[model samples]
Target: MKSLIENPKDVKELRENGILFSRLGSDEEVVELFKEIDTYGLGSRYVFPDVKMRIEEHCNSKAKTWMAELIHTYFRSPWTAVALFAATFLLCLTFLQTFYTIRPAN
Candidate 1:
């Protein structure tokens, strides 16, 4: 956690997300606290090994990563999302019209 917080903005984001709470003074104080804390003697002990392993597995999955990238790229804005929906609808309508035109009617 200390390594992750490099500046006051990082501290502010963590505090906004309820991940960090400090009554010392401000976000800068929280950053300073993390900086001053000594983590050299912390013994190696698994607090939640299973949860960590599950998170690692999820991160390693290619399908999940691809899906996340797809969403982030195409659905980041409302206009892009609407454009994708309209394109898909048009393609489906084109396919149906082609099928009806090629079919023999009684």
Candidate 2:
């Protein structure tokens, strides 16, 4: 099948980044990348839209309100949500630190 990208510049960039449609290992991966950044398939099934929708759903709410709403909806309460966010942030920080701190598998 032909490539899905519409822009010549982006197409060139994808090839340079080794991110072309055929280069993608699976059809699902091709379909689930960003439309603007990906430019490879029918458009992402997730990722970008979810981020945008999340942002839009909150509309003009403040950052703290947004976080609290997110926490209350998916979590239980404001406190729990804050705790969860902190835990996740710390977990990611530790994981990233460990990942980078590794001395390369020599």
Candidate 3:
């Protein structure tokens, strides 16, 4: 490209550079994206051409490994997820209903 951008003075300068920006979840869409320039949008040009990344992330291998393990365990047996959720929900509902409460006598 022809140095599409330089030290942008403001939104106006950014527009002239053909690089529009917007929030990642603003629902502005690709067409409406360039119409507005936001410094708060998530930018991942590979996945979302209209998204503008305005935040930084710091991570460690521990979290990555945990997430990977969780995903693998979840999909490996979807029934496990369903059963676990159902069991937990039923337990909460039962507790709320007090279905097993013992009556006290005077």
Candidate 4:
């Protein structure tokens, strides 16, 4: 099945990164395919799904959104969240204690 890409320039960008357009043949054929794909807004026609899938897998493997990752990790383990909160609270309390305890010499 044919896939789709959101950007046409991604073809040239991928090729510039040493990706060969094997299905489309040599540099000349690849250039022609690129133009056709660009005109039609079908970048995937020249690029392979494997590249897209690999990118997706890599992105999915990491925490793209730090908030989403925090929610997942913290919410999944409520104890850890509570511990982190407690640690933060303790640090704030310590800072306040030190500020109040250290009076300026008259």
Q: Which candidate ranks first by lDDT, i.e. highest?
A: 1
Between candidates 1 and 3, the lDDT winner = 1
TM-score of each: 0.54, 0.27, 0.33, 0.34
Find the candidate with the highest TM-score and give its number. 1
| Candidate rank order under lDDT | 1, 4, 2, 3
Worst 10 residues of 3 by lDDT: 50-59
Query: Model 2: how large is the Cα RMSD against the reference?
Result: 19.6
List, residue by residue over 1-106, the lDDT tens digit for candidate 1: 7665768986876687577888888888888887787768654344456765675688689999899899988789899989989999999999999998999577
TM-score attained by model 4: 0.34
> Candidate 2 residues 1-106, lDDT tens each?
1233434554554565566645666444544443335445545444365654554556456886788677668877577769888999999999988987885555
**Please, what are the lDDT tens digits per residue for candidate 3 over residues 1-106?**
1122223333344544455664455332433444455445445323432222321121235776688679787757888889889999999998866754654344
lDDT for model 3, on a 0 to 1 scale? Answer: 0.49
Question: In candidate 2, how many Å is residue 21 off?
Answer: 57
Sort by TM-score, top down from the best:
1, 4, 3, 2
Task: Give Cα distance to truth, residue 23, candidate 1, Å.
Answer: 13
lDDT of each: 0.78, 0.58, 0.49, 0.60
Give the clashing pairs for model 3. Answer: 41-52, 42-52, 42-53, 43-52, 43-53
